[model samples]
Target: MCDWNVDPEPSKEKKGRLARARGNLARRHSERLLAELYAGGTLRARRDASAVLAFAVALVVHALTLAVTAGGIWFIVRGWGGWGMVPGALLLALGWSLRPRFRQLPKDTPVLRRAEAPELFALVDEVAGTRGVDTIVVNDWINAGVGSYGVRGRRLLVLGLPLWEILSPQQRIALLGHEMGHYVNGDTRHGLVVAAAYRSLITWHYYFEPGEHDPLDEAATLQLIVDLLYVVPRLLVLGVLTLLDRLSMRASQRAEYLADRVAAQAASTRAALEWMDRMLILDSAAVTLGREVNRTSLNRPRGKQQTDAWAKGLWERLAADLASVPEREHERLRRVGALRAHSVDSTHPPTHLRHACLQIGEATPPAVVIDDERDRRIAEELADARTKVALQILQDGY
Candidate 1:
């Protein structure tokens, strides 16, 4: 017999408290680990610890989900044709509903071959040194990242053509080195798995999420009852997942610092610093440029020649803006802190901190030369592809 009349509020409260305590403990442990890494712990030590923790959590989650699913099925089989079957069937349905779905890496973006962009490939090789590269993908956004894809876990380097157009040759080298650093430090390998696990947990929570119900509605009573049955457990699960995500993010930040050190070593420290500052400057400039492009309908290019000319003009303007910035103003911009401090979920450390870290280490001179001809050739090769992506963005009204 079930005690349906019994109040569930007390149990809910207890679970809430337990979840909060666990979250706090996880946060504290993560912060302590981060502090140790910053204070003097080796990057490999911190990385290995975080990777182990993430893999353990992921395994536990998958195992628990499988057990619940199997138990539900067994109950259904044993309790067939009776009132006992109701609970078994319900449990089975819940387990199946919350099962994690397959997540595929994005494949819509254009892929560039080494033969198509030999100069760009040369730069990548120069920056990466002995590191192996599976592919280089070019997109239209002002972002870049290194990712592992497919069952064989091939490493892919995605570079934004717009970002490439703006950066000087030395800055480009620094950017490549920083991205390759993620691969070198094993951030790409372990971080991707942890991220996928975190995302799956979040997705599962949202799958069974209850919608808002009006308190005055006749069905509100039943809705409230269902909420009591469902929401508390979901919240507890989500809280734990959130805590794990925070730990993963802490590891990601440490990886960023390590990658920055690698970048500084591979490229000049000055180049790395300048590259970071350029990101901030470019972000601001991009906003203004976007508005102007929207107002002028820059996407409605009459022909390839027109598009190429407009792109060239846009690059010239951006370059002039970057070149005109006074050193003192750049320094001032660096000193002014962000309005909101980075939360535990943030993957990268603050730009100022990254700059300071780079300053600490001795750096080799940038291997790539600042050749305008090479930059021009790379830009020309990517111009048509960038134009197509830009048109798609405008068509989507983004």
Candidate 2:
């Protein structure tokens, strides 16, 4: 069985020793690889800032519109019934108070039943125990969309669908290792603080801002108006959050690198990196295929099997051709134009970018292979066991 038990009272020195051991186990060029990972994190932070700026501009424009409209509101509300402007203002204020800072944590968080999968819990606990840190709390939730989040107090929000798809046992270990790095590095706290600040700003912009009032109506009309208004500020906040997310993603990428390094030290960074690359490729392929299916369904002509067959056949051929290529070839096959086609409106970076990061020597230095045979055997065994455990948990007679 997988070793899930961790001593709750591990020391700092012990934690450091374990980390070093893990790092060296892969025999990678530790110093250089670490630098590259840190640098990538910095880049992600910059991108997150860009997203925030976009949201900020939108918020300002909204405020100005509200200000201009507010002047005429005095005239408009001169003889209105009901509670005059008070009720409208109150409701608007209340709605703003509840707006999410970033979109709800990715949607799939709820689906990955962590409670059922005991090994996953043990895995996280082991890392935390080794680090001499409190075990990060893991919970499942279906967020705005499917995604996981690391919060303060060593808390982890795992999206059900995303987790189900993302990693193998070794890769999952590496991913968890990366998350532990965030906890170790205080990133979880940073994320929460940033989120809180963004929430506060959004609350202020929506509720207290004098410019946001409806002119003749006293309140913003339509759900869209409220949505739009919220979007601007929230988007601004999301922009910031996105920036931070990118930063976090970058940080996450770094953490991935580090975890790979640790895994490499223990086994093979190449294997870990390769695993990550495959996972990303699969995610991108799934997204692309889903989009195609959705668009086809939406635009399909109102007809039966005969009319749909030709178009369906054409799409099938195209999909088959695309799917025929190896996952590693996604970057090579994806054109800049084609990349644009895929970039409808995703907060996360492009598939190629993720793919590019997964490539060794872009920023990461060369990793040394330890006992490849041993590592391979252990990885396979762990993976098979986890898969069985995960499957049983999923299929449990509830």
Note the Cα lDDT for every prediction shown: 0.65, 0.40
Alpha-carbon runs more than 4 Å astray in model 2: 1-92, 95-116, 127-154, 157-167, 186-190, 199-267, 283-398
- How many collisions per candidate? 0, 30
User: Estimated TM-score per prediction?
Assistant: 0.75, 0.40
lDDT (Cα, tens digit) per residue for candidate 2, span 4-92: 22223322333343234333322232233345644764322223453354445445534644553563355337625645566556544
**Residue 82 displacement (Å), model 2:** 10
lDDT: worst 10-residue window of model 1: 337-346
- What tens digits encode model 1's per-residue C-alpha lDDT throughout 84-198? 6887887777667656554335577667767787767777777778644667777766778877667677777888766776777778888888888787675532555556566
Model 2 lowest lDDT segment of ten: 138-147
